[model samples]
Target: MNIVLTIDTNFAPQAAACIASVCENNKDVSSISFFILTTGIKEPAGKKLHTLVESYDRTLDIIDIGNIYQYFDSDFDTAGWSEIILARLLMARFLPVSVSRVLYLDGDTIVRRSLSPLWNTDLDSNLIGAVREPTASAERRKALHIADMRYFNSGVLLIDLDSWRSNSIEKTLLDYCRNHKAVLFASDQDAINGALATRIKELSPSYNYVNSFFYYPYSALVRMCRPAQYISRENYEAAIADPTIVHFLGEERPWRAGNTHQYRSDYAHYLSLTPFSNMPMEQGWETYFKAWRTFNTATKPFPMLRYRIITSLIPTFMRFRAAKRRRT
Candidate 1:
C-alpha cells in the first residue's frame, strides 16, 4: 500500500505519531510505502522519522517541495494555507508513473485499523474516494456551484493517479483556483471538489471520523443544521465506536493541552513511541475558550439567537444539567 503525507517542520512530530499508528496497526501489510512531501524539514526531524519507519521495516520517501509552487504560474491567494497543502494537488505529477493508486492522509490523522479494505476498495470509474464534510450544507454546495451534495473533506483521500492525470484533474484544480480565488474557503479542498465533482466516490465515515465526532452535542448540532450533508446516525455511531482513521480536523489538536477529544490519549500513546516523546505539551486554554465562544456564536443566525437566549434565560445549574443530558 502506498501512503502519502504532507507536512512542515511544525507538524513533523504529529506526522510521525500518525505514521507510527499506521505502522503499528497495519503490520500485516508486507509492502507499505510512505511518501512524505515537505518544504525543507530539519535534518534531525527527518532522521527521526526515517528511523521510526525503518524500525517498522517500511520504506519512507521524502520529496522536497520547496520550489514546487514556482511551476504553478497562478496568482491564487495561498496566504492562510501552507504550501504543503498544494502537494496533494500535484501528486499525479510527482508520484511514480507506475503507481496507479495511493492513499493521501493529512498529517493530523491516525490510523486505528488495517487499511487493506480501504486500499482494495473498488473505485470503479471514480478519480478519488473521500468522506463528506459533516459541516458542509446543501446551501454551501450550491454556493460553490457543485452539481451534487457530494462535497468531500480532503483529509483522507484514496486517489487514482492514472485517472487524475488522464482527466487533467491537476490542471482543472489550478484553473479553478486561479479564476475564483476569492470564493475559495478551504483552498485545496474546494479546488478538488470543484474540479472532480462528478468523479469522487464517497467513502464511509469510519475512514475519516472527524474531531467533531468526539463531542456528541456539537456533532449533533452540526448534523441538525445540514441533515442532507451529514452521515447517517448509524454510520456516525459505528465510527465513534471503532474508527478506521481518527482525524484531528479542527484547530484543537491532541498535542495541545485543553483538547478534550476522546482520541487525544490515543494520539499521545503513539507519540510516546516516537523520538519526540519528550516534547512538551503547550497550554491551550485560551484556544479552547475561543473555539467554544465561536461555536456558541457562529451558527446560522436563527440558531445562534435561540442558543444565546436559551442559555441566558436558563438557570446555571439547569443549563449544566441540560449539557450533561446532551452528552449522554
Candidate 2:
C-alpha cells in the first residue's frame, strides 16, 4: 500500500506519530511504503523519522516539492492555512507514473487496525474515495456550486492516481483552485469536491471516523451532512466502538496535554514509539476543564450552535487560568 502525508515543521511530531500508528497496526499488509511530501524538514527530525520507519522494515520516501505552492499565496484567502495545504495537491506531479494509487492520510489521523480493506476497495469509476465532511456548511457547498451538497473532507483520501493522471483531474483541480479563490473555503478540499463531488466514491465513515462523532451522534451527522446513502445506526455504533482510523478534526486534537479526547493515550502511545518521543505535550489542566465545561453547554436551542458558542470561548477561559497559575 502507498500511504502519503504532506506536512511542515510544526507538524513533524504529528506526522511521525501517525506513521508509527500505521506501521504498528497494519502488520498484515505486505508492501507498505510511506511517501512524505515536504519542502524541508529540519535536522534530526528528518533523520530520526527515517530511522523509526526503517525499524519497522518499511520504506519512507521524503519528497521535497520546493516552492511551487508560492504561486497561490498572493491570490487566495489564507487566514489559517499554510503552504502545506497547496503542496498536498501536487502528489500527481511528484509521484512516479507507475504508482497508480495512494491512500493519503493527514498528520492528525491514527490507524487503529488493518487498512487492507480500505486499500483494496475497488474504485469502479470514481476519481477518488473519501468521507463526507460531517458539518459541510450550506454556504460553502453553494460557493463550490455543488447542487447536492455532497462535499468531502480531503484528509483521508483513497486516490485513483491512474484516473487522476489520465483524466487530467490534477489540471482540473489546479484550474478550479486558481479560478475559484473567492469561493474556496477549505481550499484544497473545496477544489477536490467542487470538481468531483459526483465523481467521488463515498467511503464508509468507519474508515475516517472524525472526532465530531464524540460530541454529535451518528444520527446527527446524517441529519447534518444529509448524505444520500448512510450506514445503519447499528453499524454507526459499531464503527464508533472500533473505528479503523480515528481523525482528530478541528482544534481539539489529542496532542494537547489535557485534551479530553478518548484517543489521547492512543496518540501518546504512538508518539512514544517515534523519534520525537521527547516531544513535550502542550496545554494543561485548564484545557481539560474548559473543554468539558464548554461541551456541557450543549442545549436544546440549536445544540451544535450552542456548543460552538461555548467552544469559541474556551481559549479565553484557558488563558485566564494560565495567567493565574503563572502569578502563583
Candidate 3:
C-alpha cells in the first residue's frame, strides 16, 4: 500500500520521527512508500525527512508543493487546518497516477503497528476511509447533515487516489469553499466537513484517537473508561512497546523535547527510535498555553460572555412584562 504523509517545515523534525517510527515498528512491512507535501517551507523538508525513513533511496519521495494558497482561499487561516488541505492536495498531485488507495497521516503521528489493517479496510467504493473523530456526536452529526452520525476524522484518511483524481475532489472542495465561504470555520477542516459530510466512510476509534479540546469532561470520561481501548499515555506506552502509529494531535505536540504532557514519555520512546534525537525540540508549554489562551479570547470567550449577559437579563425583563400583562 502507498503511504503518504504531509507536513510543513514547521514540524519537520516530528515528521521525520513519524515516518521513521512507522518503518521501525512494522519490520515485517517494508512495502510502504512515503510522500511529503511541503507547504510554506522554502527548501524541501520532504528531502530532509527522507533520510529518516530507513531505506533512504527506496522508500521515500518528496513532492515540493511550495505554497498551497495558490489554489485555496488565502483569507482563511491554515495554521490549525493544513492537514486536511494537504491530504487532498497530495492525493491530487503527489501519489502515483496508477495508485488507487493512499493513507495520509499528520506529521506529528508515529506508526506503532503494521498499517496493513487500516490500508486494507474497504472504502465500500467510497472516496475515503477514516477513523471517526471522537467529538463528532449525534448533534454534530446532524449539524453536518449526515444521518448516520458518523463524521470521519480528517487527521488520518484512507483515500481512493484514483477516485479523487477522476472526481476532481480538490477542485470540488475549492469550489465549495469559494461558494460558501462563511460555512468554513477553519478553512480546510470546515470546508472538507462541508464537502464530504454524508459521503465519509467511518472506521474504528483506535485508528485516529484525538484529544478532546473543549469537551474535556465527557471526552476524559470516555478516555478513562476505555484506556486500553484507545490512545492515551497508557495505551501509547503499550503501542510503543509493540509499536503501529501514534499521533501527537492538536496544537500541543509530543515531539517537543520539553513537552511535559503525561504522554511525553511515550513520545520520547518513539523519538529514541527516530532521527530527531540530535535536533532540539521546539519552545516549551508556556508558550503553547499562552497561545491557547490568546486564541480562546479572540475566538470564543468575549462573544460568549456577551451572550451570557444578554440571557441573564432576559428573565428579569420577561417577569416585568408578565406583571404588566396581568395589570392590563
What TM-score, computed on C-alpha atoms, does each candidate reach? 0.84, 0.88, 0.71
lDDT for 283 (candidate 2): 61
- Indicate the worst ten consecutive residues by lDDT in candidate 1: 306-315
Per-residue lDDT over 1-328 for candidate 2, one digit per residue giving the tens place of the 0 to 100 score: 9999998767899999999999999887888889989878887788888998999999998888887556464656533456587766789989988889999999889988889999999887898999877667655677888846677789999999998899988778888888888777567888888988778988877888886677676666676665344567887787778788888876668777657778878888999999899898776656665856565554533656754664466457656644654575
RMSD of each: 8.2, 4.8, 11.7
Cα miss at 104, model 3 (Å)? 0.4
Q: State the weakest 10-residue window (summed lDDT) of model 3.
A: 221-230
Give the runs in model 2 whose Cα sits over 4 Å from its true position: 71-73, 227-229, 284-292, 300-304, 307-328
Residue 216, candidate 3: C-alpha displacement in angstroms: 4.7
Off by over 4 Å in 1: 137-139, 216-231, 284-328
For 1-328, candidate 3 gives per-residue lDDT tens digits of 6777666666777777777667766677647778776665445554456666745334777676665666766774443344335445445765678777788887777666677888888888788786645443333344444535444567688888888888888887878777766544345555566687656676655566555423243334243333223335454434334434445664466655344444566666766655556666666566756665565456453444433443365446555644654575
Q: Candidate 2 at 199: error in angstroms?
A: 1.1
Question: Relative to the unseen true structure, what is the C-alpha lDDT of residue 141 in candidate 3, on a scale of 0 to 100?
Answer: 41
Q: Cα deviation in Å at residue 153, candidate 1? A: 0.4
Can you give the lDDT of residue 277 in candidate 3?
68
lDDT of 1 by residue, 1-328 (tens): 9999999887899999999999999999989999998887897999999999999999998888777667565565454556678888877777888888899999999988899999999998898899877555455466678745567889999998887888888889888877766767567898888877888898988899885455434455454345345566676677668889999975567887676667899999999999989988877466665766576456534553544553354345444544654575
